[model samples]
Target: MPRKPTKGYWVRGHFVAYGSEEDSELKRAAKWDADLSKTDLKKRSAHLQAVGEQLLTLKPSLLQGLDLPPSLREALAEAKRIDDFEGRRRQLQYVGKLMRQLDDALVATIEATLAEQHRASAAQTERLHAAEHWRERLVADDAALDAWRELEPDADWQRLRALIRQARKDAQVHPDPAPGQAQRKGRAWRELFQHVRAVLDAHESPSTVARP
Candidate 1:
């Protein structure tokens, strides 16, 4: 009887037999974390599949900027359009296969892009929180204006004062709640939040202001 044939895929014209010594070396060279075994290979495949799924969620302009093969791009594009459950699973498997063919550098680029986007999303949340904090303080205390002025010396102080005054007035007037409905502050409340957000967006951070 003939010996069982090895199973693998080709990488850059070289056939990489799964879980073989050569496979382990290539993985190490690519800076992958684990020693290759049948199990590790499965984990690697699943990881690549997850990365491929993340690629599907990439913005269209960012996706276009990636240096991907035409076939992989088409597969990713098709995966987005697939509405059928089984069909998407099969298409994603195909995407995972293509992802494996990518060189180590391109894989690093994909990871970096995802990480950068994550940081950007976090910064946006932080900015919104900072704005809310300032808006609350300004509406409650006249002294908060001095702290805000120190942070943004170039801000339109008069405009901020007008918004804060109106927001405070709106906050003091309480109306009876209708059933489950909460008390809604007037437009100035919203405008105060927006104004603070604009100032915060223009600067790095309140703590980083050119402190005396």
Candidate 2:
């Protein structure tokens, strides 16, 4: 009869223990594969390229806060000068490559700066829209003046009324252009918007005297 195989059996004359060296090797291989999948070269390069493009859109004043290296700064400048489609693309690729060598913390700072700028821009847009809405309401309805006065009692009532009247008259005299023509606002209309914006801004300012 053949010898009974033990816990450490011999496979082709070499000792093969179950769940020992073989299991360790298998685990190591799996971890290596996982690491490779996570740090895919192509994916990293693409992400860096996208970040470079976003950086290009930011104003030079804003970019000064990023404190990029001299080489990277030069790369961005060169990239900006590249007007040809393919040349710009290649320059941007080079920028991405340079970016990859930068500290991760620097990248985070750049991203945060961009995010803050976007938030500020959105807030400005909201304020402009609010001003426009108030201007339109004041011009269209006489009662809107009463509501506005209640909110801003210190406002110059005479000037505000005059502006609104002129804006309305201008709108009537220069009626909307034909469908194909570009509708352009007249001077009075623009002045009314400016006056309304100033009043709203004053109300929001801390220096303005609040009602008792």
Candidate 3:
């Protein structure tokens, strides 16, 4: 007769025989988990549920890249269509359960993706601010042109200088009339902003020149 196979479960690609030391140790760890207070478990559940909810806000492109299980993805999609508050809550709870089943590596990847998106958004806002600051400085200070030339050596200096000069003249002629009046900036001011933004964008490869 063929030998009987060992009664065991595979863990981390190893067969853990039933009642073996490794299996006993694993059971002990589980016992510790079982001993956790209900309050602690609830808190952990709530945190995981919140992370699951964040998937709804994720961009479609980013969401598609995640290696989520079919059941969890389906649950999330259904949750979005759920108009009833109670039903949606229940669906999301299901989502949380599925999230808990995800391997730590996948969870880490999700966190990293969210962080990357956040950083990109912040960098875009910073770039816009830098362009605006440069435009103002270029108009107010003549020496700012030389500074800008150093920043973007290949930029068309003649057009930039003309735009700056016209922007300054327009500001002097049409100052912010009063607190209640609309902020009326001339065409040159807007053009200068566009120019600065273009230069900053073009320079991102060699070096980021859009600093305040």
Candidate 4:
């Protein structure tokens, strides 16, 4: 015989696992440990974002003094590694968008501040126009890409892409109901089940019926 499927919280901290006093205590301890880990994860995320922001600001200054205080430098270094992995890896989707805004703002700032540095009016205008044009392309491209993603979300060009394509094909072949249809069906089924249950419960009650 096939094993029956049962659903209960299998995670350590969940209430279902702690039916007894001893189990409850163990659950509490596990919860506290998980809380600590979550706290560390959040703190690391913040620290890494701070480091990335610092890198962005620092990279802009071509001839500025480079020395950070020792403690800050240590923090920055750790932040840089974490930022590189999580920020770059997970957040690459936002890079084109962010780069567009950053480039536009930087160009405007530079044009206002460094127009005199270019020596010739034509050179300054040309550079300014180029920067603005590049910024526009970046914004437009990002928007187009985002729209395309919405229409076809499986953009990951990896081994998983084939699996995703197959799943999409299967879904197209056997499409699921729209979101609310499932909920409506579920509610109707639940009502029918409850009515059946009530009938069964009433039949099992102490009231005796006559058989003619």
Candidate 5:
């Protein structure tokens, strides 16, 4: 008797035999597509969850403009109350699910808020660094005094000179002391930082005046 016909199907010009390599490959391709689709959805969910967590970091007053759904708003509030790591994770997941049902406008709002916060933080950091640079220059170089005087003609030059002298002396006496021990020998250095920061702040905001 002739051998039973090999089980197979045709696709285009190729015959894919059952239990053959070609048939196995076809199944794998189909499964891969399904897996890829699921993976994309998972990634979207994770991204939404991250956005929700970032929104939670903002103050409630700042969130008032977003006009978020009641369910999402409540979820964010509840997430804050959940101190447990796993519980917060679950709550955030729920928030992500809710986010999927909402429009893209909410995501855009959250991103914009975060961007503004980052810009403000960067500006504050730049101000702090400028103050620190001025402090160091005033202490280490005598000519820096003239530069500062040119910038702030109304500053109490006499008092600032005295503070700088004392600060330099204090720094020499307690060079590289432990973190909190800098004030043990004298607070002159700390006072100098405060004075420089005040001067810079006043310069940045001309309406404000540096305190004596």
Candidate 6:
């Protein structure tokens, strides 16, 4: 750690701890206990309090045009609830922009937070993919389909139903193929398999791990 700068609030050559005050008015409070003599502490405390309030009040306005982390800015830009209205969208955008300006040091904080989420999401996605493949192989051998059916009965049933439906439809639509030929063609089964796999893929979570 570098020595605290004697000249200004910012250390000229070092990174200070987060939320450190620029002025030393607040230092007295840290130096002495809050239960000290009221008269002695009153003057310094009052001035420091006033300065703190003023700094906070002006800080937001000052930060209004500062740049933010690109990832954070992009995330904020893309923030939209499922049922978000246009007005709410605009409000969120304005809020995000304002926040970006005020908290100049928040870029790192926001990125770190998002990185954690990304890592977790990635882990979950990996787990889901593993589950899908394991189930598929299991279904292929002994009871692979049975395992899938047990895990996701609705999805499994729907896939089977769709394949049967398509087979019937194809048989009716195209009279060229023989009766059992259409069923064995496997196009309908292949389509249903592809569709089910796609649905599983869509449910996969993206990795949120931070990269250098």
Q: For each candidate, what is the lDDT?
A: 0.80, 0.75, 0.82, 0.39, 0.76, 0.46
Question: Number of clashes in every candidate structure?
Answer: 0, 0, 0, 0, 0, 9
Q: Among these predicted structures, which one has the highest TM-score?
A: 1
Per-candidate TM-scores read: 0.75, 0.72, 0.69, 0.17, 0.68, 0.29
Ranked candidates, highest lDDT first: 3, 1, 5, 2, 6, 4
Give one digit per residue, the lDDT tens place, for model 5 in 1-212: 99998889998988999997557657755654677687776786678777877888776567887888888899989998999999988998888767765556768888898778777676666667777787888889998888777557888888899999998898888777677663454687788888877766656552232221
Error of 6 at 90 (Å): 2.2
Question: Among all windows of ten consecutive residues in candidate 2, which has the lowest summed lDDT?
Answer: 203-212
Q: What lDDT score goes with residue 148 in model 3?
A: 84
Runs of candidate 3 exceeding 4 Å displacement: 1-32, 35-39, 78-94, 180-182, 205-207, 210-212
Alpha carbon deviation, residue 95, candidate 1 (Å): 1.6
lDDT of 4 by residue, 118-165 (tens): 344444344444333432332234343343233235544353234334
Clashing pairs in 6: 118-207, 118-208, 118-209, 119-208, 119-209, 122-207, 138-144, 139-144, 139-145
Which rank order by TM-score, best down to worst? 1, 2, 3, 5, 6, 4
Better of 1 and 6 by TM-score: 1
- Residue 122 in model 3: lDDT: 75
lDDT of 1 at 76: 88
TM match of model 6 to true structure: 0.29
Pairs clashing in candidate 1? none
Off by over 4 Å in 6: 1-84, 142-212
Give the clashing residue pairs of candidate 2, or none. none
Q: Top model by lDDT, which number?
A: 3
Better of 1 and 2 by TM-score: 1
lDDT of 2: 0.75
Q: What's model 6's overall lDDT?
A: 0.46
- Is candidate 2 or 6 superior in TM-score? 2
